[model samples]
Target: MSQGKQLPEFENEDDLAAWIESHDTSEYMDQMIEATDEIEVLRTRFSTKPLDVRLRTEYLEAIEELAERRGLPYQALVQRWLLERLTQEAPDLMTK
Candidate 1:
């Protein structure tokens, strides 16, 4: 973002919303500049098989606590941990 960048002054949220309704997002795309180390987009998709497991209450609580602090679902945190371990140890395990 550049300093002193001026945006059109709208009367209120309704005005802004009305303006947006008439505008194409691409019209302002040029105003969007990528900052250093910023990502343009993030997307993920893959076929997955569901895995269900019961965890002891204490373990579940610990996972939930850490996941909350990291802003991730507990299952995602678990999956990432498993993936990291597999990638570090036997990378072949991740394929099948």
Candidate 2:
């Protein structure tokens, strides 16, 4: 639902193959594989169910304030935080 975060839609291998072929260049295969690997990492990291955390009123307010200041929804802020943490902890698990 975010402004620029549309989920990907790949109907089938033919569609994907067409896309790959259309974008093909000498380095495109390597880049495409790297991007696919990165997407797999993202799926593995973020597919886990969220854990419930109890927060004090003031702490919750602070988080909300920070999210508002960054112009991001609370969930997006949390996702970015987790992604950053994961990338820092496992540098090889991320891609450019």
Candidate 3:
């Protein structure tokens, strides 16, 4: 690492990620340090299976428009709606 060049402070992960995306890490290799303390890692796994459903063109277009407005994919919006309805109809099934 160059003595004159120092790592810039980032306000958040997005800013750090942006900086890292544009810059070369090899330049800062000397400054990088490995963690010496013990660390615990916890991971959660979710199992999902794909389901295909057919819908009319008009309904699909409407769903896509609504999903775009809500900043979510149309498929995700549909999944959410299905989950909501299922929860309403069978709350006990959702607990499992």
Top candidate by lDDT: 3
- Number of the candidate with higher TM-score, 1 or 3: 3
Candidate 3 structure quality by residue, lDDT tens digits, 68-91: 999999999999999999999999
TM-score of 1: 0.51
lDDT of 2 by residue, 1-57 (tens): 234433345799898777666753444333334434433344345345777888898
Candidate 3: RMSD to truth: 10.6
| Candidate 3 residue pairs that clash | none
lDDT of each: 0.81, 0.70, 0.89
Per-residue accuracy of model 1 over 2-51 as CA lDDT, tens digit each: 34434567889899799778876554555655568956796777888999
**How many residue-pair clashes does candidate 1 contain?**
0
Give candidate 1 regions above 4 Å deviation. 1-44
Q: Report the poorest 10 consecutive residues by lDDT, candidate 1.
A: 1-10
User: For each candidate, what TM-score against the reference?
Assistant: 0.51, 0.41, 0.53
How many clashes show up in model 2? 0
What TM-score does candidate 3 get on C-alpha atoms?
Answer: 0.53
